[model samples]
Target: MKNLRVLDLTSCVDLLVTPKFSGCKNLAILILERCSQLVEVDHSIGDLKCLISLNLKFCTELSMLPVEMGHLTALKELLMDGTKVEEIPISIGQFKQLEGPIATLPDSVGELIRLNHLSVRDCHRIRKLPNSIGNIGISLVELDVSGTGVSKFPNSIKYLQKLKVLRMDSCFFKEFPPDIGELTSLEEIHASWCRSLEGGIPSEIGKLHNLRILRLRHSTISSIPMEIHQLSNLQTLDLLHCDMIKELPRLPSSIRELHVDDELKSSEIWILDNLRLQRLSTSKLPAMIKLSNLQTRRLLHCNTIKEVPKLPSGMMDLRVGDELKSSKIWNLHDLRLELLSTFIIQEEIQLSDPDLVDYFAAP
Candidate 1:
């Protein structure tokens, strides 16, 4: 037992208590997933100095972890989701990764000052975060609360100055902290599927000079703050399925990917001057004069556009609906470029040239 390195007891529903691991000093991985009857873990589990991964997911009866867990200095990943565990031992602060569906996190969790990543995804019971989380300081690089019931962020979140990635997708939050701008190191924020989010994005987001990607897909936001144009380093912006957005604000020239819906067909979008755009999926086909660098274009559901604008020479993919395919200006040979990969047209639009069809059919 002392030499055992991996132990997987997954789906052991009858397991009531974990065996003492004092004799398995070299055990590096222990999985007790789906042990619905498990009520306690042996304190001797702390004796496995070489243990690196411990998974106790779906242990419905487990409510507490042995305090000696802090002794596992080499532990790196600990997953306890689907368990009844509510209060984690302060010893958990020694771990770098902690994920679960616990109701609340103990303030002692802040002791993990060196933790770089923390995820509580799908923890529907969690409504708020512990204020002590702010004490994690610059070491926290990414924080994910997606699929949780959390409706608000603790004001202390402003202290995560070094956080770079934040994923709150599918959460219940309606607004972001006004001090979100204080997170100067943030690079990506994915709040997609947050249908409850309204009141528009905080203009303070302009303070995120290093932000690279911002997605608010399926939200109820009626307008984007003009301050978003200040994100000079932003490269990707996705607002697809946001039917409430009536107009788009001027975007930065650095943007490479932009996705929007047909609701803005009549809205004036001044993106013709952005030369660096690489991918554009929109219902409005703007004039393409300075778009030599564009690679992909999806002009679907654009029944209002009468004529097809001159396309960029570097386009690699073009997908259009029946309206644009049947236009008098639609010519396959003129668009048959060297870089074109996928040219998707509606089935109703018949192909006149058999050679063009065969070229696309070539594997």
Candidate 2:
């Protein structure tokens, strides 16, 4: 069919071979996704000069593509996730968007100078990226290698000055690229569930003036770099399940949310003498005598404290168990937080400001 522009045979499990597309000169989209038994794609696919999208997702047994495919100069998007393809063809640099399960990318990938987003998530065989990756750094905005075998980044990653978001969660990398701080335009970094990530964060990370959100949950990191306090634009920091950290450091003044939970038995110490904060959640209450800017606080499973520190006057919400009453840190009868809306405490303790009960009782 010379006029055929779109041909989608998604999930055709019995389709072991693709028919020659030599007659479909106008074909613009070809989708062969989820064809579990598909083993070969006819080389005549190159005859479709107008092809713009090609999807071979989940084609588990398809290990290779014909070199003739390089003739599809109009192709824009290519998806090969969950396929057995081990390497990308050097000609693949012609595409603007690509997602794959391939083991290695051709060095020609650097030729896609305009390519912005690249994802190789769950590609367990890819252990290293080509140094030529820096060739596309000028236009790349985001890169995701999450759930991949990439244990480290090439030194050339520092050349990605325009990169904004990076995600590598659930990876086994032991440390980050030492020059990670060079990505001055970065805004968010999600590295949670990196259980094997050890060796404290590089001090260069403090140089990211544009960084806003940083999450390193469930990691084995033992300490927070003192340089972290330099992140003036930081807003959210999550450290839940990070049992290895022994002491908390002074965080940025712009922080709005902080979640810290250590091991159930470790004597974790917190040195939270902050400038400004809105939300705080942790297992061991820190010495926040200076957290006057705090608005909300939640103490979870905290039964080891001997005394509770002074609560911020601006506190609007507080959630705690019977542990607070058991500690002799402050006089409950003198507590007069007027803005507290939610206070979950033992009925035996009464606050001096009777108005607090009215806010809590409000719908």
Best by lDDT: 1
TM-score for candidate 2, residues paired by index: 0.81
User: Candidate 1 — what's its lDDT?
Assistant: 0.78
Provide the overall lDDT of each model, using Cα atoms, as 2-decimal numbers: 0.78, 0.76
TM-score of each prediction: 0.80, 0.81
RMSD, one per candidate, in order: 5.6, 4.5
Residue 216 in model 2: shift from native, Å?
1.7
Candidate 2 lDDT, 301-338, residue by residue in tens: 34444456667656655555555554344434434454
- lDDT for residue 6 in candidate 2, whole number 0-100: 93
lDDT of 1 at 241: 91
Candidate 2: regions farther than 4 A off: 1-5, 23-28, 47-52, 73-76, 263-281, 287-289, 293-309, 314-340, 343-347, 353-363
Clashes of each: 0, 0
